[model samples]
Target: MPTLSESRSRLLVSEAGIPVSNWETADSTQEAVSLAKNLGFPVVVKLCGDEIAHKTERGLVRLNLKTEDAVEEAADELLSSVTADDGEVTLLVSEQIRGNRELIVGLVRDEQFGPCVMLGIGGILAEAVADVAFRLAPLSRSEASDLIDDLSMQSLLDSFRGEPAVDREALINVLCALGDLGSDQEVLSVDLNPLIVANGVPIAVDALVETVEG
Candidate 1:
């Protein structure tokens, strides 16, 4: 597998037919403000440099910001919040996505399975419910069975009484792709938590990826 050894290039997550906000790479303070006007309405700003991870935890990400002035202010604030140990920082300003729920899809390498996939109810309640399931890579229909039979979180996927049910099949597709990634790509780490499934469909709201070391 070809390892992601370059620090200058960022991973691009483009999917055909999926409606996502266009993200602009802001190289400077003035450029950030100019990009915001074109991005329109409410937006989110974050440090996209290789040196930064845990942006939310570090207070390096700002949300629900509207207007060029707020963007500029937030941009400066985000830049100053964390020091760039990697020398320079690249920033991203994107349109904000609105939703109430959060779901997680991720991968963890297992010695036996090589690369395993994980899915669960995300956010604060995930811990309480322990709503998570795992499956081995190169998943087929039979492998998806583990998610239904072995995982303790199946109840969350259903609709009882007045509640609505999520698109279960769509979730399964994500798992299949993760399995493919583990087998085909040298994926060290990935966090697609809180994928923002709404009205029975899933879209990645926030994500993080790291290259695996051989």
Candidate 2:
């Protein structure tokens, strides 16, 4: 199997109507700093490359960088780290988003079910919680709604603290699109974690796609 890079994965999902954070790719610390400045302070910086996945685990991700100096330092460290491994690297700078709710959306192929869409609570404890629901591909609007309602922690979607309730229609759209993508034989799986909700809109922060090898 072949896997799409983070940037490529995000692009593929975005083309399918999923909302993703705005990002720019850079090849050097200086370029990363410039991109970060252009995107504004308190941005996210990560090493990006075809072979570099699980950036957080590799210490390639820098978050909430609030100063040019900080961005420069992070970019330098990330570039050095990734380059040492692959001999080359690209940096990705994105606008930092603030959200308390994290969710996961994905697709997988099953022997009996064929393509299936999955929804679950996400974040560091995603595996621990294991609260997820699934539906077959090409989900109808009603099926999409049921998928959300099926989650063990449905309260997460309701208005909590001061945050507004998650936009159900937008969430439904994302799932339905994923369902459509799942139906493609070329697509093997998709892992979209930390699909953060900000001001009621869900934005995909990180994603990975596994595709059938030629």
Candidate 3:
């Protein structure tokens, strides 16, 4: 099995009608700084490579960089860190999104159940919370809605700390798309974690896709 790079994974998800944050890839600190200027301040710099997962754990992710100097420094560090390990690296410069609500949407193939879509409470503590739900692929709108309702932490979807309520319809569309992706046998699994809800809109901030060998 081969893992798709985060940028490629996000592109695939975006093509499936899921909203994603604006981002650019750069190979040098200068290019990264230029991209950050165009994307505006308070951007995130992450090392992008097929071999690089759990970027935060490897210090390959830098967040909330509010200035060009910070972007330059972080980009340089990320490039060096990943290059040291993989010999080549690309840096993803993305808009920094602020949100309190986070969710996970994924696809998996089960021997008995076949393809299934998953929804869960997401973020750094996602594993700990483990509030998740699953439904067969190719879900109907009603089934998607039911999946949302299945979350144990339903309150997170509501307006919290002054933020607007999550757009349930958008989330349904995401789940439905994941279902469609799962229906494709080539795709083994999909992971869209910390799908941040900002001002009621859900944007996938990070994504990964695993595929079977052809």
Candidate 4:
């Protein structure tokens, strides 16, 4: 299995090839805090180690904070809950993705396609309404564009009321990056749900990267 870090999960997804975002690694609480501080306000803090599936389910994640002190508190809560008596722990703090909208983009391994791409309206919105879309890997710009249009809440992209329009190019880039990760790397699952958006900008709030056993 390819480690998300060693695999350069974010690096693999690019605007040059498709579209992408930035990522940083955190091996310690201090490091994660530093990263969160550098990334600026409204970021996420997560426990980024192996042997775990859903951080939220385990109470191993925190969201929407503006201070290092708050991050430290959240990190402590996550670290304490996810660690075993005999195991070590590592944390990853990400830039808080702010926006009124939330969305999910991920990849699933397929027997033939290797990796299949997925999209959905995220956060509580996705929960309330089951708006999701999927497509095969190695998609053309046209294919991706169509996939976006096919979404049930596609009109949310337009600048609603006084809100700004979502940076569609950026959103498409994130989805394509997930597809690329599944294609070029050996991954079991790539889940970035509640990839929050505010004023049309998207940032992955919670992520789950796992390896599939063959």
Supply candidate 1's per-residue lDDT for 44: 80
User: lDDT tens string, model 2, 23-124?
Assistant: 988888899889988988799998777677678887888999999999999988876675555534678899998899999999999999899999999889
TM for every model, in the order presented, reads: 0.78, 0.95, 0.96, 0.76
50-131 per-residue lDDT for model 4 (tens digits): 4554556666667776898888788777766765741444676666555677777777887876678888877755756878
RMSD (Cα, Å) of model 3: 1.3
User: Which digits, one per residue and each the tens of the lDDT, describe model 3 over residues 1-214?
Assistant: 7878888888888898888888989989999999999999899999988877677788778999999999988987776565555534689999998898889889988899999999999998998989999999989999999999999888889988899899989899999988989767788999999799999888999988887851
Q: Cα lDDT of all candidates, in order?
A: 0.64, 0.88, 0.88, 0.66
Candidate order by decreasing TM-score: 3, 2, 1, 4
TM-score-best of 2 and 4:
2
For model 1, give the 10-residue run with minimal summed lDDT. 1-10
* Candidate RMSDs in order: 4.1, 1.4, 1.3, 3.7
| Runs off by more than 4 Å, candidate 2 | 83-88
Which parts of model 4 have CA positions greater than 4 angstroms off?
A: 1-34, 85-87, 111-114, 125-128, 212-214
Error of 3 at 38 (Å): 0.7
lDDT by residue (tens digit), candidate 1, 85-169: 6346767877776555567777778777678777777875766877787877767856765674566656656663344666767
How displaced is residue 175 in candidate 2, in Å? 0.4
